[model samples]
Structures are given as C-alpha cells and as structure tokens.
Target: MNQRRLFIASCVALIATAMSFAIRGDIMGQVQQELSLTDVQVGWILGAAFWGFGLSILFGGPLCDLLGMGTIMRLAAAGHIVGALLTIVSTNFTVFFLSTVVVGIANGLVEAAINPLIATIYAGNKTAKLTTLHAWFPGGIVIGGVLAFLMTQVGFGWKAKVLTLLVPSVIYFVMFMGQRFPATEREAAGVPFGDMFKELARPLFVLVWFCMILTAGTELGAGSWIPTIFNRVTQSATQAGILQVVWINMVMYLMRQFGHNVSHKIAPTGLIAVSALVAAVGLYLFSHATTVTAAFLWAGVFAVGIAFWWPTMLGITSERFPRSGALGLAVIGATGSFATALSGPVMGWISETHGTAQVLPIWSGLPLLLIVIFGAIYMVDKGKGGYKAEKIA
Candidate 1:
C-alpha cells in the first residue's frame, strides 16, 4: 500500500478518536446533571477511558507487531462503532463508564498501529513527519468541537453529538479493509525481540520513559479537565466550555501543522525543556485568570506548551532507540496514558474538594518538575557529543 494512503487512513481513524474526546469533554455537565452523579463519580467514568487506553496500548503495540497493523485497526474500528452506540444508550454510570473504556481501548489501538506505521514509512524524517501526522489529533478536535457546538446551538442532545464519530469510523474501516501493511521498522531491520527488551533496559531509555509519565500527565490531564475547569472559571457551561475547547484545539492544530519548522530549529530535548517552562507558567496563569480574555490568553500558552510533547516524545524514542521498535513506542504511549488515567481521579478529587480553580495550579507542578528532568537530558546529550537526530535505515 502507498504510504500516503496509509497515513490518510490513520488520520481518519484518529479523527474518530479525537471526536470521542471532544464529545466526552463537552457533555460532562450534561451527563452529570442527567445522571445525578457527583464530580468524583464522573471522574471515575472519565478515568476509566484513560486507564483502558493505557492497558490496550501496553499490550496492543506488541500485538500489532505480531498480528499485523491491519488486525489491530480493524478491532479498533469495531470498538469505536460499538462503544459509540453504547454511549448513546447509556442511562447509568456503570454503563457509561464501560462505554468510555471500550472507546478508550479503541483509541489506544489506533495509536498502537499508526505511531509505528508512520515511523516505518517516513523513516528519514521521523520527528517532522510524526508531528505532521499527529496534527490531525487537534484538527479532529477542532472539527468535533465545532460540530458539537453547532449541534448544541440547535438544541441537539448529547447522544446525537456522539453519533457523528461514526462517519469517520466507517470511512477508516473501509479504507483499511483490503490494504496490505508493511512490516514494522523493527521487523524490517531484523531486530530481535530480546534486543528490543534490552534497549528498553538502558538507563537513558528508563529516564526518558519516566519523564514521559510527567509529560503525558501535564498535557492530557489538563486537557481532560479543561471543559469543567473553564466552565467554573467562566460561569458558563455549554457555550463557554465548547468554545474554549475549540480555541485551544485550533491553536494546537496550527502549532502542530507548523511544528516541523520549529523542530528543525530546536532539538527535541531543548523543545521539551522550553515546553515544560511555558506549560508551567500557563497553568498558573490559567488557574488564576478571572476574566475570559485572560483565560484564553493563558490557554493559548498552554496549547503551545502541549503541542509537541506527545509526538516529539514518540519521535525521540523511535529515532534514538531504533531497535526497540513497536514495543518501545507502546511503552512510551502506555506510560503517558496511565499517568493521565491516574491524574484524572486526582483532578476530580481536587475539583470535588478544592474547586476547579485549584486544578490547573496543582497540575502545574508536574511540568515544573519536567523542566528539571528535561534539562538534565539536554545536559547528558551534550556530554554524549551534542544532540544527534537518529534515523532508521
């Protein structure tokens, strides 16, 4: 199959996942109100999605290598279709939680397949291309937020908002139906499974992986709670929440679309360090913002901070540790997902007790800590003869 076709299909699949994320974020208030659930209860439901995502990719990456990307993607498409239907029909917290878990697993499977697929195909320009591929995540969020916002303007229920994801879901499923998939980078390089494990055991790999936990937490944890927090800060639920999400996602989309240029100028580790500082400050400002204007300004800063963390981390890992293959990418992704999973409840608990105003400031500490860690990585890389971008042959 053509690499462009594969990339397009992967983007379509990811758009479905991003739509689910937007719909879930937008409908938090509605679900809570209609179901008579508390902040903590809603947190559990949301947390289930991140946890399911973590678990699936933790295993799914290896499975993609073993069983092929096509199998994992097909399963992911099925999960999206079934999970969306279940969410539409959910009347209780348990059913709703289960539905998110199913969808989360589907999202994880998409990541498991596409991350490596892009790496394998665009072997020469891993960082730039990977960043370009992931731009669709925010792009999809923009589309989803606009659609959900317009639907709400017309007084369409939350259920209808969820059903919109099926459009992309079916399209990707058909696109992937009869396509042939190339072997993963590791497989093509003939790297042994034991070698992959050994690469992961290196000290540098472990350090970066640890930092990934904080990076993922900083980006995803805040994104998951933005709607609720913004609603509280702005004193508006529907329009304020959806509009804020759209604004943030649009900033992210633009940043990521142009991120390759930025990556060319700055090393990945340097970018991570800068991002951590910006994100920390943004979170603090966002938490303290008393006006909508202030909130949007700070949120733009936050978007800039988060824009490159996910894909850059993947690019760094795949470039530096080429032998680790799908397993390494899987572990990196799983770490972030799991951290987001844990932070979800923590954010909920904070919002439940301390109010949403306190959520961003508390979460800001992770990025501050990340600044230190990424700085250390920069120093270490310099000692190792400067930062050299790696490419898979």
Candidate 2:
C-alpha cells in the first residue's frame, strides 16, 4: 500500500481507538448519570469494552493474517456503526453497557489486526513508522473530545455524539474496501502459522512480551482511571470531562509525532527510561492537584511521559522481531490488553470502596514497574546483543 492509502486506513483504525477511549472520559460520566450507575457499575461499563477487546484480540490477529487487513478493517468499521446505533437505542443499563462492549470489541479487533498491518506495510522503519501511525490515536482523541464539546452545545446530546463517530467508520470502510493489503513477511516467505508462532515464543520474545505487559498496563491503567481520580481529588465533575482524557491524549498525541525523531537524536531506550520518571512525577502531581489548571497540566505531562512507550515498544517487537508475524503481535497485545481490561475494574473498586486516593498506588506503581522492567530489558539487550540493532526490516 502507498503511504497515502496507509495513512488514510490508519486514521480510520486510530479513530476507532480514539472513539473507544473518547467514551471513557466525558461521555461515560453522562451515560452513568443517565443510567443511574454506582461507581462499581460505571467501572464495569468502562472496563467491559476493553475486556471484550482483549479476549477477542487473540483471534482477530490470526484472522487478519488469514482473511486480510482490508477485510478486518471493513468488518470493524461496520461494528463501530452498529455499536453507535446500539448506544443510541439503549433504554436500560444492560443495552447501553452491551453497546460499549461491542464498541470495545470492534476497537480491540482493529488494534490486533492493524498494528501488524502497519508493521508489514512500512517494514524496515517499524519504530518510527509505528510511532507515527499510533500518533493518530491520541490525535483522534483530541478531535473526539473537541467534537464532544461542540456536539453538546447544539443539542446533540450524548447519543448523538456517539453516533457521529459513525461518519469515519463509513469512510474507513470505503477506503479499505478499495485498497490492497500489504503482504506479511511470513506469507511472502511462505511460512506456516505453526512455525511462525513457535519462533515467536523464543526467550528474547518473552522479554518483549514482559515489556509490553508493563508498558501497556501502566499507560492504559493511568489513562482509563484519570477522570475518576480527578473527580475524586478536586470534586469537580465538569472539568474532569474533556480535561482528563483530552489532556492525556493531547500530550501523548504530540510526543508520538516527535518521539522517533527525538529518539534518533538521543536514544529510544534512554528516552523511555527518563520518560517513565517524568510520568511518575506527573501522576504524583496529578494526585495532589488542588487546582483544575494544575491538574490538567500535570495530566498532560504524564501523558507526554507515556506518549512514546507503546509505539516505541511495539515497534521494537514488530520491527526488531518481524519473524513472528501476526502471532507475535497477538501475544504481546494479549498481555497488555488483558492488563488494561483488568485494571479498569480494579481501579474502579479501589476508587469506589477504598477511595480515589488508593488509586495513587496503582497509577504510581504501574510506571515505576515499567521503568524498572524496560530498564532491565535495556540492560539485558545491550549486554547480550553487544550492539544496537539499527536495522528494522
């Protein structure tokens, strides 16, 4: 696929991720109020979609590799449209929550399918390329949050706000339908699934998976819980809406655009390690925030810290280890997706029963854990490889 087509398709895919999370921030509070939910119940609704996405991702990856990225993209676009309609039609918590899950599954399936697609399409420039591709996600979040602001003003309401996301779903489906899928390295080499999966499980592969779990867990856990945390800390329901996710994604969006460039000049490993500490400080500042402006700034700072972690790390796995193909994407994604799925409710329960202050440990501990683990991986890779592997393809 040409870069133009790839960029269009990636925008569609990233929009789904942005939309999934867009709901998590502002609209979630609206839905909860309309539906009359408890904190635990809200967590379930928020977490349910991720759970659907995480559980089904293992299947989505292989299917994409088997059926094709264009097919997966079209199917997932249809899902977002359906999910939007379901959310609009919902009359009860069951229906509304179920709709969120549908959206989550669609988003999860798309992530599983496309991350590998980009890795294959761009091939040699996986780290920089993936960072650029993932940048669309946070950028889309900024769009979604801003759209939500406008939608509410024109009497669009929450349901209308959700259904509006269908516009891109349609456009994405059309683009992908006319496009050609880039061939996976395994397919070009005619390797079978059994062989590809077996090779993906090697010791170094395990280290990559470890890094994915920690990074994903920390990032998603922090992003997902930020609003609830803000609401509790400052007791301002209004500001927390676009502020939390919007701020987080905005900083994330910007860094993702520049991360690879910065990494090239500095070093991706050193940048990641330092970024983790920045994130920890941001989270601490966020937890202690007394003013809304301070909170938003701190949130953005934290997002910047987490900004490059996912794309850079996933780029490492996919580019540095393309021999694993779609299965490799599946395994690494599984670890983090599952962690995010679990963290949602866990954070909710803590915030609900133990109070939001308890979230400090969860959010703070997550990045610290990632910094430690990825730092270890950095040491191990440096010691063993005795060389910085610059070649991506």
Candidate 3:
C-alpha cells in the first residue's frame, strides 16, 4: 500500500509526457524549416500527435482494464524510447510525423493508465489529488521550456532539445520497474463492462463529455500552437517562443499547485463555468496583443483560465460517474485530444491565410460555448442535491 511511491512514479511519467509537448512546441519551427513544410503541412504533423493520442486512448482505456495498468505503463515507456530515437534520426516529413505519432500514442497511454490510477489511489480526494498529479504537466512544461531556452542560448540543436526528454523518460521507466499497480475503482467495485457503458449513457455524463471537447479544445488547441503564434505576433527569432511557453506554464504551475483548495470552495461544474468565461476573455485579448507586455499579460490570464480544465473535467467525471471507471476517463480524454487534433489544422490554416493573431478569435468561440454548456451543467448538478464525490467501494 505504498501509494506515495506510486504517486511519485505517476508524476514522473506525466512529466515525461508533458516534456514531449514542450519540446515539440519549441522545435516546431526548426522541424518545418528542415523538412521544407508549409504551415498547413506543419499542422498535419502537429495534428497527427493529437490524433494518435486521441485514437490510442479511445481504445487504450478498456485495454488498461483488460490488460492491467502496469502492462500499459511499460508499453508507454518503450514507445517513448523508440519514438525519441526515431525523432533523432528523422530526416524527412514522413519520418518525423510517424515518429511524433509514436510518441503521441505513448503520451496517450500514459494518460490512459495514470488518470484512473490516481483516482483509484486517492478516492477520497479525487479532485484535489488529480489536480495535484496533473500539476507536473505544467511543471514539466516549465522545466522543458527553460531547458529549451537555455539550449538555444548555448547554440544547441533541436535534436539536443528532444534528447533532454530522455532524462525524465528514463526516470519513469526505472520507477515503473518492479512496481505493483492497483485495480481500477470500477473493477474493485465489481462493476462490469455493461454497467460502465450504462454510465456513459447517462444524460449528465453525456453533457460533461460534450463539454470536455470544448474545454480541451480551448486549453490545448491554444497551448499546442502558442509558441508559433506568439513568435509570429512578437516577431522575435530568439527565445520569445520558448519564453512565452515558460511564462504561461509558470502561471499554470502555480494555479494547479493550489487547485485543490479552489475545488473545495467551488464545485467542479461551477469552476468550469467561471474558467470558460475567463478563457474567452483571455483569448479575445490575446488575439489583439500588439506588444510583448500585452501578450504576456493576456497569456497569464489565459493560463489561469485553462489550468483547471483537464483535471477538473476528469474529476467531475470520476465523482459523478464512478462506475464508468477507466473507460469513462479515457472517453473524456479522447474527446479532448480529438478536439485538439481537429483544431491544429484549422488553426494552422487560419495562420496561413489570415495570420496567427486571427487564430485566437476563431478559437474563442469554444470557451464561450463552454460557458453556456457548463453553466447549464452547474445548475443541473446543483439541483441534484449539490456536488457529491462518489465513495470508492
């Protein structure tokens, strides 16, 4: 029952996953130039990462239950090692895209295993613990961003930036070695696959799943493209791209560190409602940023808005529909990743045709939509005797 070790190991695994995102975002320009790719083509490459993530987790959830979390985690570790090697050796767009897809599946598998794993371990405080566990995501981003910035300052190549990911990757692999995994909450509760599917058919669960699409799109769509978009806006070729990423992640890191306290005061649905409104305002202002100061200010605001999104949505699902188990969490995660995958190309197309600044306004609609959807969800949940966390059986 050494939950602490398992928790630390999960955080390390997530750090590796998040670092991949940071490195990919940082080196996107280099990858495009070396491969002679257009903005649209770059979108395809970036989009593929999310697509692989979405598709893998779509199925990986049930597999996690059937195959065991330890098996999935080991698979993710192998994927990370192989994908990094492929990325290091890639010399063409096809090779690079394929490599990213491999890494993306690894990332998805990590989410597939860890989301439910953490929820099961910290059943009493699912929201708080999940938020705390996910803090490493932004934490990893900050570390990766700083490293990428320093590497660029020292005249290192993108390959070196990518190679830095191996440090955490190796740490997670070793931590996962010889570890024991707990059964999923659903499995422990003796909830069969049929009951899990039945939970998915519930009206509230369906609403939350739909909201997950917008919540993820609003957060990750902008997050995945921020480095390139901000660089274009600031027109700086130095550390501006990576620095902006660092700034946003710094804000996100702090917010997530304290998210558990915030969740205690406000219900998850209410939090999502408020977060969506703030994100909409942040996105609108970011689209209009004409100065570095303005961009940083808006980005900070946007970070606060998005910080709670992924974990909070998962928390809500875990609390409200405990029976759905890993499949429930995976479906929501898949929806978010799919939205991000769909948005990458559209955002790139906007940048290619209209400009990077224009990408924000078009995406602002997603949060606005969430404001309406989650607003209704909050009211519905409130009417049902307010928020209640399901007890793990």
Give per-model CA RMSD: 2.5, 2.8, 2.3
Query: TM-scores of all models?
Result: 0.91, 0.89, 0.92
Candidate 3 lDDT, 1-393, residue by residue in tens: 678988998899999988898789789898889878888878777777888888888788998889999899999988998899899999988889999999999999999999999999888888889998899999998888788878988999999999988888888888888888999999988888788899999988898888887888788878878878878777876647656778888888889987567898998888988988888898789878888889889988999999999999999999989999999999999999898777777787988998767888888888888888878877876899887877656
Global fold similarity of model 1 (TM-score): 0.91
Candidate 1, which segments miss by more than 4 Å at Cα? 28-41, 91-95, 233-239, 348-356, 390-393
Query: Per-residue alpha-carbon lDDT of model 2 for 1-393, expressed as tens digits?
Result: 575786667767777668657755558777778878788787678768777787667778788768887777777888888988998898778888888888888887878777888777666666777788888888888888888887877876787787778887777777776677876666766667787677676887786677676677678877777776777677785756446787788888878776657656644666677788888888888888888888878887788888998777777677556667777777777778888777666777878787777686556766786677667766766787632543323
Q: In TM-score terms, which candidate is top?
A: 3
Error of 2 at 285 (Å): 2.7
How do all the candidates rank in terms of TM-score, highest first? 3, 1, 2
Compute the lDDT for candidate 3.
Answer: 0.87
Judged by whole-model lDDT over C-alpha atoms, candidate 2 comes out at: 0.75
lDDT of model 3 at residue 161?
92
Local distance difference test scores for all models: 0.87, 0.75, 0.87
**What residue runs in model 3 are displaced by over 4 Å at the alpha carbon?**
32-43, 233-241, 348-357, 391-393
Instruction: State how far residue 35 of model 3 sits from its true place (Å).
Output: 5.4
